[model samples]
Target chain A: MQLKRWLNNYVRIWGVYDMAYDESEGEGVWIYCEQEKGEIHPVSYELLNKGRELADDLNTHLTALFLTPDGSDAQELVYRGADRIYLLEHDNFNYPNEIPFRENIVKLVEDNKPEILLIGATHFGRSLAPRVAGALETGLTADCTGLKIEKGDFVQIRPAFTGNILAHISTDRCPKMSTVRYKEFDESERDTGREGEIIDIEPLEYDGPDVKILNEMIIEDINIQEAEIVVSGGKGLKDSQDFEIIEELCSTLGGTVGSSRPLVDEGWISRNHQVGYSGNRVKPNLYIACGISGAPQHLAGMKESKIIVAINTDPSAPIFDYADYGIIGDLYEVVPKLIKELREG
Target chain B: MANFSIIVPIKEVPDIEKVNFDREKGRIDRSSATSEPNPFDLNALEEAVKIKEEIGGNITVISMGPPQAEDTLRDAIARGGDKAILLTDKGFAGSDTWATSYTLATAIKKLGHYDLIICGEKTVDGDTGQVGPEIAEVLDIPHVSYVNKTIERGKDSIIVQTEVWGRLYKKELKFPGLITVTKDLNEPRLPTLTNKLKAKSAEIERWGLDDLLDTGDEKHFGIKGSPTSVVNIEVPKEKGRKSKIFEGKDAAKKMVEQLRKDLGGI
Candidate 1:
């Protein structure tokens, strides 16, 4: 006992003690605010809304780590919920490069030591978060659907085994981190009356192999996740050309076109139009499933929508189990008729 | 142009589509399902093989799993890999992305020389596209994710097309870099009969924690090295909704009316 006590004292004096779970060390909650072309990703605002609540639970301040080329307005982040902003402006931040971004973010986290770090699980966030976590040697949960503070522990909830199981995860290390999925939570209301502080962080010089962006192909922004109405198709379509009827119905309803994984895999539609566990998770106000048998993976993506209407010929289809309304009919006949009815009405 | 040495990391995952769920038991019966190479990892290996064909090079396939994962490595060898290595040990089980990446990076470092590494966008069972970038970070190399097409291969650099969000970017990265490929990269080829026969008798190098760890610290491996743990796992409760069925001729009209009512006149 005496030797163990002496060894503990020696380790503490030599600063070799394991600093894994020191509750007094880490402070504040941080959200990495991702921006593209001077516009912040909507998911960042959503995280800010959720981060604010988590910070309130921990009785700690909320900080937004904003790294942008043009130094886009940080005040909006403040109005949304962040108590402070860590602004890092550099021309290199224009494109999504993981190296420098990871370096700077890791340095900031090491310096400030935020207790909880949240990032949106976009393509960039998915790439950057892991690098940052690897550098810090900390744990990171990916594509979390829910996050909460329980008994002073930050708990991350995510789907495992292709959305069949939901796992509640916790990190033993400080700076508990998670990459939350988009559209999982609502954004906090912006209050112009709110005031906050913005601290400027000096950008670090990086000399690694640089990734140069030669050209950017402009693709139409298909923001299906933010759509109010979504009309999705599935294998029930006789041919790829049958998507025209689904498109007509979607156009008539002024909604977006979505498809099950098979249709997307068959090249009938683009991946952005896919709604499933592997594709986009959409929480639109109204979701219309045409000929979709509703596999568990597909249901996991869109079941959270306000209302779901399933159209299929088989009454025994699993879609009916989760659909708010079920229509037993051929989509080819039903979709065209629905379009005509909407046109006439 | 010099020949490139490419490394591809693949994973064996339970066939998620075929896995059965016991609703009463509130658990997934993964044992009933067969295991297969992660679909996207095949795309990564296909890209690596394509690169080897275009430019004279060697391909090394690596994986971390149980002893049975040797089958996955042999399959990769049959597919086009010139060599295969399996990093399997009892100490490497239950590793999160961080520990898994660290272990893979250590193995890659011990392998000596490589110009490029390729990985799938994500695993099917884990569904976390994290290990690739984490590996690159541990190695202090540049990485690009969601790469759909390889544009050009130069002496010391390569250009590729990647997608972020909804935009397509043409990016150029130096050698000794990593890329996580998407399904759009290319269709994987089936193993040839001759190659399959050759792979049946091929020797695969098996490495354990003792081989990779120089510090003799087992804490950097397996569940002990992992910082994250699943506290609880539960089958997601079905959010049952009102299943109002409409049939006959007015089904479409009824759906439209109900949608209009719920959405306050669409």
Candidate 2:
């Protein structure tokens, strides 16, 4: 295959930033655009939209770093606000692997010298961001919910101390980077009138590390982040086994099942299915809260849903404030009835 | 026999449940909160201890927190750490992950050689799982994040299982690499009486920026080196749910009808 051929004859620039580089200023807000299998994640567009504001504030270009195969879409990025696209096309680099991807992206960062770099804090970005930050020897803020340009610096705001406090971080270093959480901001409005340039990167002869990918199933596991409708439970569920009812409701409604931190702490559900400020910031079409008292932390995670329906026996439960519809009844009774209706529908 | 040089970089975070926000000050009132060794770091230490048990190795636990963090260091010792290093420098007060990683990496270089570095997946305080990989980069090594297990460790390479976006991947990396441990790595071993006694006498090494790094470069250690600043603090407003309460027999069906009318079909 073409990937096999390129892997053998690639070029390697090991530790390009190992030596100290002068504090030279660069102008541009760069977004690390990522894709899975081939589908471009919506977060990239959201970041591009966010980066455009920063680029405009800095009077610099808005660049999208597309490290994918050549077949990936380039038009959507420009319409979404990217002014320039740096395409690192390689057949071997279909999936975002941290090691080799870092080797390549770091090379580009060293060459281009972006002023501010924004990456979506998805599975791929989280793994890839540190390597780039490490190589560039610059500061990075992880899981940022807010990004703004104030007096010429990119200020990264994120909930710290596990949602107890927000820490505002700035990077005096070049290419101030932040891994932004998805669904925290609205996607940039698309416009076909926008235009951008796409530059192809030359082939790199770097081979994958000694570690081999034994089996990459790429299973489409359902989680809160990707769910259209989410059925969530809280401490009121009492026993972990009751989560099966939640699963049944979610499945019947054609969505994903989610839980609060206590459920996850009790090992009732995997961390992926957790919903809270520390967990996924989900923006599903419909969010069903069952027996959730709606702590401030939990509220931050799911309150942004388009429509919320809270089922709690307690009249004073906090979840009802953010919820569009509140059902004051026992979840065991309310949930099974809702499930039966959903199944019938 | 391959004895591993395993280093786990951990943090002592404020007890979040007790933390409160001061609306007047526009900042969190962290003074009243207790401190706990970040749980993720404990998981990393557990993974390190397990590797030590399976093979043969010395585990050096490291942290860059207030001197009060010595309690956390002792806890690490009580678990499985053979030695502990507390990088406490007044210069590191406001250091971000970048500066923190640089300081930790410089200290690691001073310690001579190491085969592996493990970090908790993320701290409950900062919640940024960046330091481990950042340190690897500063030290010019590869790293794996979200690691749940160390499947195998041969002479020159290690095999690990990492969860990425709800999918699991088994990775192999050469020595001198780093891996951040997830909370699921293993239930951390609680300190025993014997280990606690051993920990009590264990001398935790303390290093300031001047000891292991060039104290002159303000950009390498603390707030001077930190580029980001917390310009604003916003405490999310607590808006209670709808005050309406419908009770008795038909409440479930009635709620469903209202939900369907207002929220639309699922």
Per-candidate local distance difference test: 0.88, 0.79
- Distance (Å) between predicted and true CA of A127, model 1? 0.6
Worst 10 residues of 2 chain B by lDDT: B237-246
- In the range B89-157, model 1's lDDT, one tens digit per residue, is 989999998889989998999888899999999998899999999999888888999998999975477
Off by more than 4 A, model 1:
A1-23, B1-3, B215-217
DockQ versus reference, model 1: 0.74
Candidate 1 residue-wise lDDT, A209-313, digit = tens: 478889887767687877889999999998999999899989988999999999998999988899987787888888999999989779877988988889898
DockQ of each: 0.74, 0.48
Report how far off residue A317 is in candidate 2 (Å): 3.5
Interface RMSD of 1: 1.4
Q: Which candidate comes out best when scored by lDDT? A: 1
What does candidate 2's lDDT look like per residue over B54-97, in tens digits? Answer: 77889999999899999999999999899999999788898877
What local lDDT does model 1 show for residue B69? Answer: 89
Q: Which ranges of candidate 2 are over 4 A from the true structure?
A: A1-24, A151-153, A162-166, A190-193, A207-211, A340-345, B214-218, B236-243
What class would a CAPRI assessor give candidate 2's docking? Answer: acceptable
Could you tell me how far off, in angstroms, the CA of residue A83 lies in candidate 1 after the best superposition?
1.1
| TM-score, chain B, predicted structure 2 | 0.93
Query: How close to the true structure is residue B34 of candidate 2, measured as C-alpha lDDT?
Result: 86
